[model samples]
Target: MSPQWFVVYCKSREESRAQRNLENQGVYSFFPKIHKERILRGKKKVVEEALFPSYLFVNISQKDEKFSAIRSTRGINSFVKFGMSIATIPDQQVKQLEQLCHVNNKLAINSDDAYKNGDKVEILSGPFKGITAIFDIEDGLERSMLLLKILNQDNNISFKNSALKKAES
Candidate 1:
């Protein structure tokens, strides 16, 4: 049978629990991750593994007997939806995720500071174009945020390295 990918509906904020439960059940799944510095109650900074927030992908046969097995698993709320059926994830998205997993090294997530704060760059994707913005680089250089200057406000926009081709000279 061909492999099918589907989005699993996890309990509100209980994605980790669902992932663990699925693994214990011997179900093949994937949860992509990235490193981000977060502030803890200790007022100290530390890197924590967050479950990319609330999403996970599963590979299984829809009409197989095990389909019922998954529906009964703990922490799995339901399959993702559209009308009255499970929402099938697009192949491109799955491919992108596959590429991410195939690579070795830390994945860059947020662009709190992906560029020089005062550096100038053109807007890549948005309503604004031919306009310059301050490229804000983060402490880790994992990502960069483009702070657009509009009127008197700085509109912050972030982009991963692949999303951005390069800052046009």
Candidate 2:
């Protein structure tokens, strides 16, 4: 039987391990990761962290009660869904996300990020890498100042001498 892709719940910040768990159990899973350079205690470090938190996609047969066994494992919740039905993940959305990751170098949300005049602007690495930032500057592309919001808090992510572009409006 062809495996259908389903969303699996994971422990907060445990997405990488959760993917490994499913793989060890002979389940095909997708948990995209990004390698980034981080600073820890005034030291620079390279780390691999899950692109998505508390969620991973699994390719498995939608068998009766099989998910029960899956849900019992560590760092899992349940599939994302609507009332009385599990929401079907769109193939296009997945494709677009992958493309966005490659094009710019970061994950952009499925929200309207199209910016306007005087909007805070910051260039990430490539296209759409501005924390989904949007703005217009005289020399935006030459020097970009991005505000990186980490840990659910607003913080400045300034990137100078970057190639900046107007956020899609």
Candidate 3:
């Protein structure tokens, strides 16, 4: 039988250590991490943290007794099991997870502080290109409201945050 993915529970804050031990034992494993932007000491920084705290994934063949020593591996508490059966992860799901994490691993939360109320901005690349507007409150993560002047009337337009840039000076 071929090796299949399984979840390994680790001691608190020991996911990286467990992954290292598994690698040293020539066992395949994955410890997915994500980059999070945070404010520390009044400064913004990006920190890499385990996507799944106290947990990592390993590939093992259930029928291979020779690999049974994994339970005694350092930093690993035990394998995640349901009732009397160990949970097995499908290769497709693992691959898909790998791809998904790879694409979105670096996430920016409250990272950009470029906008402020009444700041003059220009629509960089959109149907409103070259149009000047006032930056308003951020509507959400990807959306913001801009105050634009059209026909001598103040009009509010909602657009993506990426669509606006500080108007020269």
lDDT of each: 0.65, 0.61, 0.83
Stretches of candidate 2 off by over 4 Å are 64-66, 91-169
lDDT, ranked from best to worst: 3, 1, 2
The stretch of ten residues in a row with the least summed lDDT in candidate 2 is 134-143
Among residues 3 or more apart in sequence or in different chains, the pairs in candidate 3 whose N, CA or C atoms overlap within 3 Å are none
Q: What lDDT score is found at residue 18 in candidate 2?
A: 76
Q: Which residue ranges in model 3 land beyond 4 Å of their true spot?
A: 106-163, 166-169
Off by over 4 Å in 1: 41-46, 49-52, 101-169
Model 3 CA lDDT for position 81:
94
Best by lDDT: 3
Clashes per model (N, Cα, C within 3 A): 8, 4, 0
lDDT: the better of candidates 1 and 2: 1
The true-versus-predicted C-alpha distance at residue 39 of model 3, in Å, is 1.2
TM-score versus the correct structure, for each prediction: 0.53, 0.52, 0.67
